[model samples]
Target: MTAVSPHKKEPYERMSEPMATLSAFAAMVKKEFIIQLRYPVEFVASFAQIFLIVVVLTLAGLMFAPDGVQSESSSDVTGLVVYGFVLFIYLSDTLWSVGFNVRREQKQGTLEQLYLSPASKFAALASRVALTLLWTGLLSIGAAVLMSSMLGELPFHNGPLALYILLMTLSGTFGTGFAFAALTLRIKEAANTAVNLLQFGFMVFCAPFFPFAALPEPMLWIAKAIPLSYGVDAFRSTLMGYPNGFPELAPIGVELGIVTLFGVAMPLLGFWLYRKAENQARRRGSLSEY
Candidate 1:
């Protein structure tokens, strides 16, 4: 160490704010919680929407059942249908809300500020997704309880199995969410309308109401290919005691693994694309125009 140059230091000696990433993430998550808590209407509305849908579906099932279809079995189907419907709503809400949220932040200029910060884009997105997932999970559980009480039957047969299925389904849903969110970074016009309109197509093409077999040939194939289709199918398997129909859990595991991998990787890729788009917008002095 021939009189180590005074200006020279070890590679690891840079003066960095340790734990800055974690602190930023924690702060972002906390901010999200505070904002969500402030809007009690959103909290109430989520449950209300799910409750109303369950009622409509149950009443319709009761009205439409064949003369010999057992009332008890119809209730099970109703519960499964309600679960699927609520899950779709919860997942779509997470994705579309992120789109609207990014739009609002872009309009208000906080989005650019977030981009300028040292916090990683992935970190920022994770915080938002965490908040969204929390709301989705909570509302889903609450809706399940309410539906069980109303239907006078619990859909879950195996607690652990149901939980595992739910987690896998959520993994696939989050992958879809990442893809949706990535679309918002550059194409900001008609964002709200886009989310709303897309919801219908999503529900249909994903086959949430009925099995893919009931869809037309082309749509049936398309539905089977979608991530949401797997989520809905797996959910039904768990809730309807039809796990054997889902290929004995191995395919479920594989799909879940693939979805989980995509879930982690897609958001990072989305963040990269989002930042590139944002930077291009700022370079053209059009950041606030959206």
Candidate 2:
């Protein structure tokens, strides 16, 4: 009788981890939604905040327009400002949600239990970020519609391109948040203050509501170095048909190239830092120490 070959595991059969990760992600998202639903007033407040920002900025733009002529240039500027603010909402919401989530869990005494679970940490964080982005995206679209109607023109020039660029922008923003989350994991008590300071710094230095050219030379250089600056300019170019805020700094295409590069690089770096922090925390038995 011929000897039967022993049953062998196939190389491609290692999908259990990914399947487990997916299951964990779905569960996390469901839990987040349920918790958020319990706080409906929070959602209402979030929506109101975006709406108020757009309305105030739209009125300011109209009020400052020379002689209320609503020249095409002025309209384009208004569109750019509105789009920038919408992007700001997305960035700030995602960053704070991801960065502070761990601290929130720690404060609730759930961080240790979370680490005890077999689910991937990255998967849990990704699900939280996804949920945050989904709600923020919805609010942003509503704000965009309100702003566009107020300005009497739609801001988005290329729907498909704008969507693609928005994804890239979100990816880079997520990376930044992921890195911040790692820092929060290491420094739980300071998480809220750190996130708030970072948000304010981004608002001032990133020039989300104005052209990069309008910044002073030193500040302009600093803004150009930031990925969000490219994202804001790319959004305006794609959504408002405006020239890049700094053509002398880089063409729109090159600016997007930089954004895409950060979109790829930052996550990898953040994940590495996250893993290192996690291991260090485990070694020190400090994951629950807050």
Candidate 3:
């Protein structure tokens, strides 16, 4: 028989890196829906629970007002509480949605197998983020509306600017979620404890329920050091019409600069750290271990 010509790679087999990445990402986005369908109850319960907790907290906060719940409410206090609560809702969910989810995969023994597939690890991480953006974004809007009714009509000002800062702040928080996911891979079972500690830190340092001015001078410095603090400051201040005593952490210009940098840089840094951790785990063959 004549020598067989060298087998040529098919066009699909020769897909470029960018196209391969896009295909993997698109598949992973579909995988998000598959996972949600498999655990429909957990998904529904989470959505309900977040809404309830926010309503209760906002209602209870108004109760603490010298005059419990009124037809009309103070715009300043209303904006401070409602806006802060909005950010809190996002951060809390990000912890569970992105960070806790990685630990979940470890416990299910899928984290390792997921990597064995040709799909990009970044696709896996980004898929969870897509879930958070959709899931939490809805919860935030619902909770905010409910809180506005319970707390008071919230001030809406600097609409376009507030939207920008809101997006930037959320972007930075997503980056934080990625970093925490990296932490989960390394710590495995300790993820719960770590999440609790992180939540407490956010509550205390970020002062999401109260204005930065309410925090003591010493405590305020800690908030000042945290970039998310600037995000909170800039977000609420702009939305509240920049009333006196707003943007307590820093000047609006300075805070905006910090939040922009945080939005741009954190995701890049967080993903880099995740890749490092992942490469190490793969090399050590610990990728499958819970």
Look at candidate 2 and give me any clashing residue pairs: none
For residues 65-107, write the lDDT of model 2, one tens digit per residue. Answer: 6655353335566576777887788788877888888778877
| Clashes by residue pair, model 3 | none
lDDT tens per residue, model 1, 1-290: 58878888678643355477777878989988998899999878867887787667666655665642234445556555666776776667767656567777778878778777778665666677777777777777777676666555765665676566667566555545555555665577766676777787778886666555567888877776665566666666656666434422236676556445655665555556666666787787766667
List candidate 2 segments past 4 Å from native: 1-15, 67-73, 244-248
> Which candidate leads the pack in lDDT?
3
How far residue 100's Cα lies from its native spot in candidate 1, in Å, is 1.7
C-alpha local distance difference test of each model = 0.66, 0.79, 0.84
Descending-lDDT candidate ranking: 3, 2, 1
Candidate 1: 10-residue stretch with minimal lDDT: 241-250
Q: Give per-model TM-scores.
A: 0.79, 0.88, 0.92
> What C-alpha lDDT does candidate 2 achieve relative to the native structure?
0.79
- Name the top TM-score candidate: 3
User: Model 1 off-target regions past 4 Å?
Assistant: 1-18, 66-76, 243-265
Worst 10 residues of 3 by lDDT: 8-17
Cα TM-score of candidate 3: 0.92
Question: What is the clash count for each candidate, in the order shown?
Answer: 0, 0, 0
